[model samples]
Target: MSRVTILVYKGFQVLDATGPAAAFEIAGHFGAPYSIRLASLEGGRVASSSGIAVETVPLAEALQCELLLIPGADNPLRAARQKELLTAIADAARSGRRVASVCSGAFILAAAGLLEGRRAATHWAAVEALKRLHPRTVVDAESIFVEDRGVWTSAGVVAGIDLALALIGRDHGDELARKVAQKMVVYHRRPGTQPQHSALLDMVTPDNRFAPLLAWARARLSEPLSVERLAKEAALSVRQFTRAFTQATGVAPAKAIERLRVEAARAAIEAGADSLEEVARRTGFGNGDRMRRAFVRITGQPPLVARTGARREPGMRG
Candidate 1:
């Protein structure tokens, strides 16, 4: 039985912390290996961005946690309180718990010196701020979340939900994680290397300039999608297309294509592809070797491991 402690501080981004907490509760319903507890640096109640108050137990009381989650907040400029938060995080780390962060929660982990010489990810808007605070940490703005060793860090806001699902998958298995995700209506799972934001728009608007292009690419996940082809389709020069694509999507075209293909492959695999080569070819990866490389690059695993160790149960054929 694993135990989890979620640390909430003042002015915390409510969704960043609560989203994952809620998802974990769904996992709990399936008898997953977790006992959830919410904690705070200061004992008693903690306030959220939306003026809602949530109960918080003392951090010290959560002594036996297998995982400790630190949530980000709107008021990251609270430098004084940051020290206290960092101290608490360090204590949690010393207790052998896998400490993780949501959004600017990476800031807390960095302050605790847990992210030193480690690769982490955070909200794209805070990339510069995180860099200035902790120069030694490699902050990848592109990723939705990162799990290096035992320290996990996620992108801003709702990306925390995805991070928690990944943890569920890691601790228990893919089947439970997928069930939790399904229950929560998280139709897709973003790999750690996938971009934090969507490829269609910088924000969540249906009127984005690249909406059509995004739809086009998504509709044809089984086709070859090279930079040149995408550029041509967008009627722009390669450099221009790359810059515009990144600006609009928060990710490069090539990266987006890889993500789409991987997602398609995962769906196909979960639907019971006969072999790696079949999954690869069906997802436009051409062959098992290419699929293996892409799997390693995107998911930090080989083809076989990703298939068997996926977070979803193998379903009926697609």
Candidate 2:
């Protein structure tokens, strides 16, 4: 069995640590070979960002392993500065075992000099921060996970499960990985190459400046949604509205509108709604072919593939 030691720290994101831990446990339950342990620098009770506490061994007790995972914390930037923690991670990296990180935990790895000149991934929201903080690291916000050299980093939350699945696939095989994912009720095991961003999440900005316009546009998707029309709704001229929308949301009005449409179409498809052409029309895609094109461009898959996979999933859909 591969001894898997996951590092924990105060303020750690509970899901970041526990989600991958659950995946490994489920994989082991299905007869995969992984002996998992949790360790922190000081050892004992670790407070998570979610207000829960978990016990951990001292870093000395769990220094070396076949794999060492560092899960992200709510304040990873702050956590990464701890000299003892960085030293422990550096020692683990030097032990010649595979080292990986989840979410903003990549910041820890980078601080330990483990991710220099390597392609890495982290929470999409933290991509800019990671890049700005670690110029030597190549950050890919578009990816669910990335592996370079012997180090792996996964983008936020549930992506850590995908990273664990990848580790299972690496140790065993794809079939075993799929089985473990199924047992965890994760349904589809999204590949590392899958995009980190969800169009729906990207479109649903909090305190959105164009929230009113977006809501209005969503209700009238099939209606002509020209930039001029959107500007009028926002009480601005087209140029002003375009600039403001792009600055606030990092997406232009047209792209944001398309994302909203895709979200609607995807919901319909997942619900087993029949008639692709009809779905497209109702979702403002004009036609099935156009919808297919949009899905391919935005989601890296055709609507048929996504819908079929969603229907065939045995448990929670990815």
Candidate 3:
């Protein structure tokens, strides 16, 4: 069996640790070889940011695991200052064990010197802060998760589960990973290259009036979402629909459609879709040039750049 250790510290995000642990544990139930344990710098009950306490063994006893996962805390920079913790993490990586982090937990790895000159992913909101703090580390704001050499990093919250699924797929097989996802009722393992944010979610507030209309548009991206059609779908005059959508989403109707289209196109590109022209045609962009322009305008990068970055191999060093 492969031992998996999750290291936690005070004020850590609870789900960042538990979500991946549950995925591994579920995979184990289906005949996958995984043994999980929670650990901390010292043995005892450690309280998470949410005030839920988890029992943990001392880090020393958990250091020999095949995979070591560090969970993000509400104030990760505070945890990053723990000298003994940093030393232990550095020593573990030097010993050839695979190490991974969830969300701001990447701050801990970077502090331990494991992420220098490596591509890493963290919560989109923290991307600028991570870049400023660790100039040597390549911070990928778009990807849901990233694996550089033997070290992995994932975006905020539920993304830890995605990272764990990827690891399970790598260790066992895609079929086992799919089974695990089915048992958990999540989409069958979103690729590591998948974008962390969704345009639909970003644009719609919980109580937005146009939420249903936006959802309808998202489900039919290939269909022309002209203002007239959306107005008719929402059962409002074209002028009223345009005004209301702009008020609810803070973007004009046309801009919202473009954002949604670009998001879909980017997802397809990163997921290894066959051709940009096909992706554009499928996502309502009509052609590759139009899609490329929209991509650059909204994402500050062309679709080709996204495809290339998604396919880039990890460096030799961990």
Candidate 4:
């Protein structure tokens, strides 16, 4: 059996440790050999940022596990300053054990010198801070998670589940990971390359006037969603619809459509077994070139790079 240890400290995000622990536990029920435990710098109950306390073993005792997980906190910089904790993490990685962090826990890993010159992911809000603090590390601001060599890092909160699913898939098989994910009721596992933010959510607020229209546009991405078509669907003149949409969502109708198309295309590129041309066609980009341009504009990378980063290992689950 592979022993998995999650290291925690005061103020750690509760989900970062528990979510992955749940995923690993469920995978065990599916016949994967995993033994899970929670550990802290000193054995006892550690209070989380949410005011919930969890019992833990001493970190030194748990350091020899097959996998070590570091959970982020509300203010990870404070945790990163724990010299002994950082030393333990650095020693574990140097011994060739797989190590991973969830959310701002990447800051701790970076502090331990584990993420230097490696691609890592953290909570979006902490991306710039991480980059500024650890200039040698490559911070991927958008990925749900990132695995470079034996080190892994995930974005904020529930993304720890996605990171766990990926690790389970790597250790066992994609089928087992999928079953575990189904048991957990997540997306099967969102690809690590999938952006943490959604274009639809970014574009519309809860009570925005055009929420329904945006949802409709998303459902019919293959259809020609011109400003006139959207205006007609909304039963407003093109001028009024354009003005209201810009005011409500802060972007022009055409730009919004392009963002939606890029978002859909990106999902298809990362998870679907479709060619770039087919994904472009299905998402209303018409061709790869147009899709590429939109992807660069919206995602800051081309579809090919996204696909390569997402599927770096063949048969790897999301």
Candidate 5:
């Protein structure tokens, strides 16, 4: 069995730790050989930025484990503890254990000297800092995440969730990961090649009451649902709704709709839709031609290849 440890610190981001934890948990349900425990430099409860407290085991207890996960916290100014945390990550990496980080946790790894001369990534805001601090680390600010050697790094917030799903896929299989993602309602399997710079969801803005509107549009993807209809459901003027939607979700309303339609088409095709035209009609793409272009744009592959259930060959790094 693989033992995994998550390193927590003061004022740590809660989602970063919990999202991957949930992934590993679901991964384990598929008979994945993984066991997870939360660890800290010292064993105790650490406070999160959201006021929720998390208890953890000691780092000393996790040293012999197969994987170590480091989560970034809100308090990056805690230089001393950050330094100590970096040293531990470096030590674990040098010892041949798999090491991973969520968001700004890449900074801690860089501080420990493990990221030198290696490709890495972090949250967009911290990408410049990572590059400046570790001159040898090739920082890709737009990647949703990166896997270098045994060390993996994810971009801001929910990208960590994608990294975990990908890792689960790597350890077990794509089918198992797909099951876990379905259960978690993640909807999309944003690959490492996906751009992290684009905002796709509006969960951060509590005031944007667009979930129902989005769901309504999602159901009628096979219809001529236009921006005018979507804005009307939100009860706002077209210009106002478009601006607010873009501000909250990070993508233009039209692009978001196209993404939803493409995702729906892929699901339909995977479920054995009679033909590409049928899949497109069911997904609101109107025709196979549009669906084909959207599929290539979003997934870097044609609809036929995706519908054929072509299994992705894992990249072996020995």
Candidate 6:
């Protein structure tokens, strides 16, 4: 059995550690042969950022760690400054053990100098800080995870499961990974190459003053969504709505409409839409070619590829 060690520290995100651990544990039930450990610097009960406590073994006695997984914590910038933690991480990587990080755990990897001059990923909220702090490291803000030179980094909390699933695939095979994902009730495991969920979802201002108009537009995606229509919905003139909506949402009215349409189209496709035409028409793309172009621009894949999650057929284009 491969020894898997999850490094935990004070303020660690509960899901960041447990998510990957559960993935491995479930895979083990299918004969994948993984032995898991949760280890902390002090090696006792560690309190998570969420105020839950979990026990850990001492790092020194963890033994022949084949895979080291680090999870992000609240105030991870502060956690990354621990000299002993950085030393242990550097030592493990130096010994050729596989190293990986989940979410802001990339901060620890960066701090340990494992990610220098390599492409890395972190939670979207922490991307700017990671880039600013580790200028030599290339940060892929749009990816769910990244693997470069055997060091893996995943974006955000849930992406940890994807990283772990990918690792399972690497160690065993795609079949085992898919089975493990299904056991975990994750039906579709997104590849690291796929983009993270839309930035449009996060572009809204904190107060969400434009949410009413956005919700209305989402519900009426099949209707023509001109700026004039959106302005009327918001009870403002076109110019006023344009300026205010941009300020409130950081996206133009028309662009936001297309994004909503794309989101609806993607949902329909993934939910087993029978044809591209129906998806396009329902999502307001009006034609498959137009929807295909929008999907390409938004998700780096055509609608058919996104729907089937594979290569496009020769005659699939409409």
> lDDT of each model, Cα atoms only?
0.77, 0.83, 0.89, 0.90, 0.77, 0.84
Error of 6 at 269 (Å): 7.5
Cα-based TM-score, every candidate:
0.70, 0.70, 0.81, 0.86, 0.71, 0.79
By TM-score: ranked, best first: 4, 3, 6, 5, 2, 1
Give the CA lDDT, 0 to 100, for residue 233 in model 5.
84
The local distance difference test score of model 3 is: 0.89
Clashes of each: 1, 0, 0, 0, 2, 0
Per-residue accuracy of model 1 over 278-316 as CA lDDT, tens digit each: 778877889988877887887787766644533342211
> Residue 30 in model 3: shift from native, Å?
2.5
The digit string of per-residue lDDT tens for model 4 on 1-318 reads 999999999999999999999999999899997899899999899999999999999998898798999999989888899999999999999999999999999999999999999999999999999999999999999888998989999999899999998899889988998899899888764788787888889989878889999999999999888999999999999999999999999999999999999888877776644599999889998999999998888878888887776666423644
List of clashing residue pairs for candidate 2: none
Model 2 lDDT-worst window of ten: 309-318
Per-residue error for 275 in candidate 4, Å, reads 7.5
Worst lDDT window (10 residues) for model 5?
A: 309-318
Error of 1 at 128 (Å): 1.7
Q: TM-score of the candidate numbered 4?
A: 0.86
- Write one digit per residue (lDDT tens) for candidate 2, span 1-318: 888999998899989988888888888887886889999888999989988999899888887688899999778978788988898888877878889999999999999999899999999889999999999999987877888878989999898998888788778776787788788888445656556655645666757777667878888877778899889888998999999989888888898888888877876776557789999999888999999988887778888886776434322233
Residue 197 error, candidate 5, Å: 5.4
Which lDDT value does model 3 have at 208? 85
Local accuracy of candidate 6 as per-residue lDDT tens digits, 1-318: 989999899999999999999999998899988899999887999999989999999987774789999999868877688898899998998999999999999999999999999999999889999999999999998888888888999999999998998888788877788789888988444657456765446667446888767877888888788899889988999999999988888778887888888877876775446889988998899999999999888778787766664212111221
Q: What is the lDDT of residue 256 in candidate 4?
A: 96
* Model 3, residue 35: C-alpha shift (Å): 1.1
